[model samples]
Target chain A: MNAIAPSFPAHVQTGALSIRNLSKTYPLKGRPVPVLQGIDLDIRPGEFVSILGASGCGKSTLLRLIVGLDPDYQGQILLDGQPLNGPGLERGIVFQDHRLFPWMTLQQNIALALKNHDLGTAQKQRLVDEHIALVGLRGYEQAYPHQLSGGMAQRGAIARALVNKPKVLLLDEPFGALDALTRVRLQQELQRIWVQERCTVIMVTHDIEEALYLGDRVIVMEANPGRIGEQVQLELAHPRQRDTALLFQHKQRLLAQLVGH
Target chain B: MSPFKALTWLVSPLALLALWAAVADAALFPANLLVPPLEVWRSFADLLATGELQEHLAGSLSRLSLGFAAGALAGLAFGTAMALSDTVEAYCAPLFHTLRQIPSIALIPMLVLLLGIDETFKVVIVAKTAFFPVALATVEGIRAIPRSHFEVAAVYRLRWPTLVARIALPAAVPAIVTGVRVALTRAWVVLVACELLAADSGLGQMIEMGRQMLRIDVVMVGVAITGVIGFALDFSLRRVERRLSGWQVAGR
Candidate 1:
């Protein structure tokens, strides 16, 4: 695999996320039902962390909290040593669905994220073009979401999320809706992009192989009032081969732990 | 369209015309009541040549445009307000719903008494007819917007104006446009009915005059023209609706 050099300017390292004793509950039939409890995690800048869990595991909920979508959680989520407020431009996220405005073309959708940024029109256009190219979606700028294939739309979503140059990027099962072949292809593309961007990434997924393949550290979570179960650290380099025995071994170990649960 | 498909469209009209000719030939009713199709056609040509049809049509169309514009614009504003603000909804929704249930025709008598049988009465009635469906659709459309859309806006940190204009309006467009289309056709029908009840000049007034003069062929001409105009209005609006919402995938 040819590794592309990072195209963005080298700014001071900033994205370091810390979640301490985070707990959340949703009201079920008038009583509060615990969804997440006592979760503590500290992530360094430029780290790729994959959170592996089953359905009802609250993994997605954890991401929603960190992204500041829902502010009804208990605990301190500090970003770069400062208490995080509601969603800021520093954090970007991609949901399972592409969520592109159907009325807008790919280029327009990506440009919309820069609506609040203090940049000139030409500068915003450059950022949009660069991100679209970064996601390998050149020559498809004028296509609307419906006109694009499922995988292409998801790629467009990724470009939109990255256009703002957020310090931290979150992905919630970003490939969950794709076919097996498309999912695999997008995983490769995601790996390549992450290697080049080198931003802090936290992805939530149930696919063990995907987690082991991309994550610098994999955190396994258990359901029933979701909590961390175990952690696995992968001492691997970028542009790593997908079919390596090391990846297979880690996948097997994670599978055994999850199946045993 | 294929030649065969185009031929199929004419089948029903031809069948109806043949049936009418047979009935008239058999003298199933009085000749004056069921005028021959040829006589009606001649009357249509005479009205066209004299420009009486054009005058009545222009009068009716102008009323429709003015009334529909005022009513649809008000509906859009009021509906958006009701959807956005709980206080507005709470105060107005009940009265709005109750008023909507009463047909515009029912209000014609009261409206005539208040505003007289003039252009104002017809315009007011058409405006009232246009408002209800549009307001209802706007409320429903805005409410139906998925929460996911709002979440995306939140994540992007979009400001208020951006959020409303870019997100909310576009998301609710298909519904609002559909509502406007319904309101327009409904207003046209109500405008004609109002003219029928009382008008110095209009297609409806022309039909009434034909009835008084025992010119059944003229009445038939007016009826045919009315149907054609209504159909043209609906068909054109449908095209606009399809064009505006071309982004929507079928079955989605």
Candidate 2:
């Protein structure tokens, strides 16, 4: 915890996540179709891990399982050594679409995520305001989702997810629908926020460059009963430049690996 | 409105009045039967002075309010139950659909025979007219909500009340409001028709009396007033709908 505000407690080293022999299947025509098979991974606290894969690689499914959206899977998911259950405030997720309710203003949307918290009204309001400002949406609190551009709405979603101060943040192709320029800008914003917050993050995406850019470690996945194929540890530091020689090399290697398969 | 747009608004009504005046002047039909626009206007003034038009309007409006309120409330509850529960849907859907298919006018004679040609008959007819559209709208509106919304609700761990009030109801509002508007207009038309058939009061009764006495000017007054009132009802509800759904993305 960098010295910013002493009143706010430092985030404990608590988001360590471990998955062992995780498998999931869906019913199709009354027959079970395997979506994920025998997946095992570990994530350290405050680490950014990106899962890179093709469209049908079950990367999103993996995120959904970890987020506790679907509990019908076969596996053990432990958060800080505790077994997982259904969704809790300890974990937050951002989907491909912003998913903000069109009827609510941005402030109201963010405030809604704090409804379950046992905090004072003023405290919740402060948290909502801080998160909105954190995502660079301070001035547009009154704007509705439909009134916002796609990138701005996604940022609002990020604010809503973070307002709960979840120990882990899951990104399911968070910027997949964005244009190239907006995607690049939002990736940088996400990286900056991650550094400031220092929470565990698992992002699923198909963009190899993005995976290499922000992730401390990138896990490449194979489709057709999705499973881990390869892992690359990036030795680069935060506040990284896009034109770095190391990132270019990693991107080239990742492209060849994905294409060669 | 811009000056040009305001001028465009005047063109249609003005053209209509001019055509009526021209036809009357040409004596295209018997003078009494044609009923010049000025003669109709005089009859309107007489009705207003005698408070006859106000009495009829008040009676019609009160019946509309009572019937619409009862029908809409029942429809809302029933529709929600059918949408949310398979048991209710299994038992009620077929019967509801068949009943809705029969126009309210078709039931007026039978309803009059059973309930007599009184307030009960008019109110029942109006309610029947209001029920189908509202129920249909409620069912479709609630069903139209995307699955993604419920997922978000689950993720947030929203309670049942929060889910219904904050997520479900607001999401379904646009559809529900449209249904209410449709039901309201339809109910008004049916009420008038019922009044024409058997009522002792209301705008429809006024027109019926005008025809019986061969007072073409009085009949013209009733017809014009009904048109104006219907337009006003629709216009106001449309404005309300726009106000409520201002957050929707245009073209979406």
Candidate 3:
């Protein structure tokens, strides 16, 4: 932990993100099918926002559009009042599947994210090492994704996403595939990483408890034309207890909203 | 390699050899018709010492290498293009499938009639034998790569070359290696058949000459050598293939 670390790229800028009247639609059998519609939201710099919804609710689709994986959408996604186009180094995403290239070692997978950056060899190595440490994967740099357990692989994915020092990190159910124990463990790790790095985070998940656990604000979504239904703000500070009465009340309310009459 | 493993593999072949020696000694068939195992071994030794076996093996291997290289390379390029682009797939898929269905051996007579029983004909037969499985493997490999993998590449904004090298190439390597192994052994078999029918200087030619001269021992030597060479080629390639796709096994 006392290792001298090379600084992030000076050009990297963290910014507040705004999604205004954002709507995405795909043609199904030559008919327009809307996924995300008239979605308006504002996220402060360094805030963690979790969007909650059921399957087909376009929760993942929204994350895809935000990460610039799909550019053919209507409306604005602005970072610091500047419209974002295609994918860039400033935006990083950890998908549900971990998505690490199986042939590459964990270090190579993380190093690959920095391919477009113009850092020196030493700086790149330092950043890769630091992030690997940040996610508590200190000694697993040379392991392949296949050799890792599911939680470790997802952590590798998170390290890869964060190695570029992005302005915003988009996680599409980053811990969706892990067991309940591992998922909860990673949530605590993510909360610590978020506090240390101070970058804006937007994660999409279906779990109500996960939404309230780490998010400063949880955005509940409705399906069949995915759009925001409600928002719950947790004003508690960092490293709050998971079973607090306030969080439990919010979880019950959210559960009703998610799977209720 | 452990001595026990080596001994275990040798057991079956030794049993077959013992059976062969017994049949020859019992004289169920005439000596000329079913040559004794010792006579075959002596002839094999005689050819090796005189370097005739080396000359024939060198000729056969050269043709196999040339033809397999050309065919496999073309198949790889064509298969990748087809997998990547609908236009390429639409144009080439039908013709490619039809050509693959026609076995390389079946084409030997027509090819000999058209191109004559020359080095070119034998090489063409080998190439044809190698092409289909390689192409099919490449296509399946590329197609089998998940959408999730591509999404990761897109998210990172990887350039065209990096995307192909890091993601596409390795992901498809296991299937392509398997395909190449199948093609290599198939091409060797087809090449030997072509040589037996047409060429003047290959293992198949040696066997053909022995048959014509009624020297069953020489022909038996060629048959044994062909089986051993094919087995060695396949075994060697499988090692290479496993190395390339070691990740697949580890993942399981």
Model 1 per-residue lDDT tens digits across residues B118-228: 999998888888888888888888889888988999999998778778887777888998999899889988888788789999988889899999999989998898888
Give lDDT tens digits, candidate 3, residues A91-136.
9999888889999999999999999899999999999999999999
lDDT of 3 at B28: 99
Worst 10 residues of 3 chain B by lDDT: B160-169
Candidate 2 lDDT over B1-252, as tens digits, reads: 678986887899999999999999999999999999998999999999999999999999999989988898788778877876799999999999999999998898799899999899888888878888988998899899998888888889998778878887788888988999999999999988888888889999999999999998988898899889888998999999998877764527
Please state the error at residue B119 of candidate 3 in Å: 2.9
Could you tell me the TM-score of candidate 3?
A: 0.91
DockQ scores for all the models shown?
A: 0.63, 0.59, 0.72
Q: Across residues A102-124, which tens digit of lDDT does each residue of candidate 2 receive?
A: 89999999999899999999999
Alpha-carbon lDDT of model 1: 0.89
A138: Cα error in model 2, Å: 1.1
What lDDT tens digits, residue by residue, belong to model 1 across residues A1-261? 125432222453889999999999999999999999999999888888999999899999999999999999998999999998999989999999999988889999999999999999999999999999999899999988988899999999999999988889999999999999999999999989988888899999999988988888899998989998899877777666889887899888888889875
Name model 2 segments beyond 4 Å from true: A1-11, A28-31, A235-245, B1-4, B249-252
